[model samples]
Target: MQTVRVELGERSYDIVIDTGILSGIGERIKGFNFSKVAVISNPTVFNIYGDVVINSIKNAGFETLNVIIPDGEEYKNFNQTYQILTELLKNKLDRKSCLIALGGGVIGDITGFVASIYMRGIDFIQVPTTLLSQVDSSVGGKTGVNHELGKNMIGTFYQPRLVWIDIDTLKTLPKREILCGIAEIIKYGVIWDEELFEFLMHHRESILNLDPLPLTHIIRRSCEIKAEVVSKDEREAGLRAILNYGHTIGHAIETETGYSRFLHGEAIAIGMNREAWLSEIMGFLNRKDALKIKAVIDSYGLPSELPEDLNADKLISHMKLDKKVEAGEMKFILPEKIGKVKIQKGIDIENVRKALN
Candidate 1:
């Protein structure tokens, strides 16, 4: 197992990445003292690995409760969050209760948010089942549900007590979902590590084929990069914004189409292409590098363009409502090169429109 510690003073925790770690989760968590345990997950995930987690906690001798939410980005809302909180309250779960988020980004976001607000704060573990969560959402401590107004419009910086990533869970993920996970994997390389980017390019075929060796390396490196960034800027006050490389436009695409239209990573894939093109026009990224990014996205069967029905005006309206906007000025993370980026502010709407097309 590869372990990375997120140093956050009293809130610090370790992220464990390995194959088949799920089976040993109970033994791993036995050291923590808690009055009760809540396992928050979606139905699809529950059907697959819920038993393993529940059984482990049972063996650990803690009173446990399972809260299963319906799966999908559309279900990530205040209603669902409230539902989970109500369940926790009904069970008389105190501050000593621990939550285990056992699904993808949506589950992690909602559960972590609930943990943050329920009784002020509670300990939680992230058992990210998808590649997207394991590498990105599960590590960062940024948690929230989508408001009707925007993606992640309501959230908090609530760090997890621990993040256990079992690569074994991903083997059961749908192929399309696995590709969605790759979008974020690509983001890590584009914004931080050139060597990692080259590694991805060289093993693109192997990654797509779900070869465990390369997949494991890809996920671990991505988590390492994210952990390093979060350590430096846990609240996203500075350098952390670079991690949003594709998110500005990506969030707009998701909101305009409704969350159901694109998977979070799919929207990010489109966002990366659009932002790369924007960078090229701004004289930062060259056309060849931009195309290289696009080719990698296309090679994995991810979308590289906005849907036909999407227009500049609708997208612009959504962008204006983005959570990253400050003083009504828009900020974007644009590529400077294959492994470099800058968070540019006051981006002209005209240029954004041109890049989206």
Candidate 2:
């Protein structure tokens, strides 16, 4: 097992990555002092791995409660959040109680948000089942449910007490979901590590085939890169926004489609392509580099182009509403090379339109 630490001083936590670690999670987390435990997951995941986790905790001599929510990004909302809070209330969970997020990103987000707000902040652990969650959403403290107005609009930055990643859990993941996770893995390579990019290109087949070694390395390195970034800029005041390289336009696409048309990583895949084109037009990245990025994304079976029905004007409008925007101007993180990036402000709308075209 390899451990990476997100150093937030009082909020610091370790992210443990290994295979078959789920069987020992109860003893692993027993070191933390808490009165009670509640695990939040979706039915799909509960049927698969929930029993083992709950039993493990129970064996460790802790009272445990399970709260299962509906699956999917669309269901990450107030109604579900309310349901979780109601469960916590009925169980009389207090600030000392810890919430365990035991599924993919949606479960982690909702569970973390509940822990953050319930009784003015309790503790929580993250057991990310999907690759997207393992590499991106699960590690970061950013937790929230979708609002009627937007994705993750109602949220908070509540760090987890610990994060447990078992790569074996991904073997049960569907191919499309694996592709969705690959998008975020690709994002880490595009924004920070050239070696990681080369490693991905070389191991594409192994990763796609779900070979254990390659997948483990991919998850570990992705978490390392993400941990390095989050350690420096926990609140996203400056450096962390670079992690949002493909997210600006991606979030817009998600909002426009009402969060049903594409997976988070898929939308970000398209967003990276659009941003790469804009980077070329603005003289930051070369055309050849842009094509290479698109090719890598395409090789993973991810979409490299926007849908024909999506409107450029509407996308731009949605971008304006993104939380990253400041003082009426949209901010974008654009690549200068495979391992480097720059955030540009007041990007020309005409250039954005041309990229969308």
Candidate 3:
């Protein structure tokens, strides 16, 4: 297993990535001093790996309660979290018990949110089952649900006990889902690693086909980059904001479309381009570099632009409510080049509209 450590002092944890690692999670959890485990997942994921994960926990001497929610971004709200908390209480899960998030980003977010608030806080392991979750959401301690006005507006900075990623799960994902994950992988390249950008460009065909070697490399490097960032800024105090390179507009896109029209990373794919264009408008990113970024997103078979039906004004309104907003000015994380980004504050609302146009 490949382990990436998120060093947050006592709150530090390991992100373990490997094929067939799910079956060993129980043994891993036992070491965390948690006796009971609450397995929170959606129906689809439960149907797929429920037996294996549950049995593994049971074999490792853990009393387990499985809470299955409906699968979708729309379901990631207080209602679902309330249900999970109710199940935890009904199951008599205490601080000594841990919650294991066993699905994609939604499951991990809601489960971690529930774990954070339950009896002050409880241990939770992120068992991300999708490409998008494995590469991005699972490694970060940011956990929350979307408010009607914003994405991840109702969340907390709660780290997990462990992040267990099994790359084998990618095989079951649909092509659209694969593309959604690629959007994030592309974002990492744009924000932090120029080498990763070129590496992705060179292996585009292999990555598109989910060839194991390229996929594993993407997962490992992406997690390492995120883990390093989180270690420095555990609470988004300063350096961590760069991780939101395309997220301000991306969150707005997810909210404006009601989280139905696009996947999380798909919305971010559009957001990345729009924000990069914003960089160009601000005289930060040159047009040639901006177009280079957009072209790469296009090559991934993802949407590199916002949907026409989305109203620019509505997106702006949603963005004003984003967590990144400070003093009535939304802070935009824009790319200046393939491997570097800048957080531009005091952004004019009109400029955002222009980017949408």
Highest TM-score among the candidates is held by which one?
Answer: 2
Tell me the TM-score of model 2. 0.97
- What order do candidates take by TM-score, descending? 2, 1, 3
TM-score of each: 0.96, 0.97, 0.94
Model 2, 209-301: lDDT tens digits are 888888888888988988889999988988999999888889889889987789888999999988989999999999988998999999998
Summed backbone clashes in each candidate are 0, 0, 0
Q: Write the per-residue lDDT of candidate 1 for residues 1-357, one digit (tens) a residue.
A: 888888878888899988888978888988899889999999899999999999999898989999999998878999999999999999999989899999999999999999999999999999999988989999989999988766678999999999999998988899888988899989999999888888888998888877778988999899889989999999989999999988888988887877777888899999999999999988889999999999888888899898888987898888897778899999999988888898899888888888988
**What are the Cα lDDT values of the candidates?**
0.90, 0.91, 0.88
Per-residue lDDT of candidate 3, residues 1-357 (tens digit): 788888889988899888878899888877767868889998899999999999999999888889999988889999998988888888888878899999999999999999999999998899998898999888878899977665578999899988999888888888898888888888899899998888888899998787878888888999999999889888888888998888888888887777788888898899999999999998889999899889888888888887678899999988888767888888988888889998789888878889988
lDDT of 2: 0.91
Preferred candidate (TM-score higher): 2 or 3: 2
lDDT of 1 at 350: 87
Q: Of the pair 1 and 3, which is ahead by lDDT? A: 1
Q: Identify the superior model by lDDT, candidate 2 or candidate 3.
A: 2
Which candidate achieves the best lDDT against the true structure?
2
